[model samples]
Target: MEIEYQYHFSLPRSVVWKYIKNERVLKNALPGCRSFSMVSNNIYKAEMDIHIGPIQDLFTLEIRLDEDQAPSLIELHIKGNGNMGQLNGQALLMLKENQGTTMLSCKANGQVTGALGLAGKRILDSSANKGLENFFQILEKEIKRRIYELKRRNR
Candidate 1:
């Protein structure tokens, strides 16, 4: 399956890039994430509880940052396995600054196998989209909180 999304953040591109690369922020933003840790440079291992349609399972995911261009672009490759299935995917994220706002565009392509694959493309797409939306909402809140804390500390 393939998915694409675009989002605008009220913060500057530099700030958005910093938060996006922070492990703490990502762990908090991901839905159902049990653990997220860096295994090596640009590589991370994560355990998450995933529920998609009628399937629910605990997945172990290996995420690799394949390419990075500072505050502009990032490419990621992911591999995951669970009792329900196996998942492999790649994603590209691009960020552009407009005024003080940061615009993010993401494109992801993936394939699923086993029981999860039986859930069909429509269900998978819907679930993925919902998960992304939830992630972004939580991420926004986390970023704002961090910014507030920084300001308070400097005051």
Candidate 2:
């Protein structure tokens, strides 16, 4: 399956990029996340409880930053297993700056095997889309708060 998303942030590209690279910040963006921590450089471990349709699972995922190009681009690989099944995916993220705002775009592809896979494609797509939207909403608020703090500190 393929997933795509785009978001706009009022912060500058550099600030958004720097803040987003932190594993802690990323963890806070996930919906129903239980725990997220770094294992080594560019490698992260995350646990999340995700619900789709009538099923729910506690997933343990290994996330890796496959490629990074500063404030411009990043690529990620993720693999995980849960009571429902297993999932693996790769995503590419790009950022563009116009004036003071930043535009972020992401493209992801993944496969599922197990009970979760049995949920059907339409259900998976809608569930994933809703999850992504929720994640972005929380992330945007966090980023704006950070920007506000930084500006206040600089004053």
lDDT of 2 at 82: 99
Q: lDDT per residue, candidate 2, 15-82, as tens digits?
A: 88887777777888899899999999889999999899998999999999855677789899999999
Top model number, lDDT: 1
Q: Which ten residues in a row have the lowest lDDT in candidate 2?
A: 65-74
TM-score (all chains, Cα) for each model: 0.96, 0.93
What TM value does model 2 have? Answer: 0.93
RMSD for each of the candidates: 0.9, 1.5
Which pairs of residues clash in candidate 1, taking residues 3 or more apart in a chain or in different chains?
none
State the lDDT of candidate 1 residue by residue for 10-122, as single tens digits: 89999988898788999999999999999999999999999999899999999998656887999999999999899999999999999998998999999999999999999
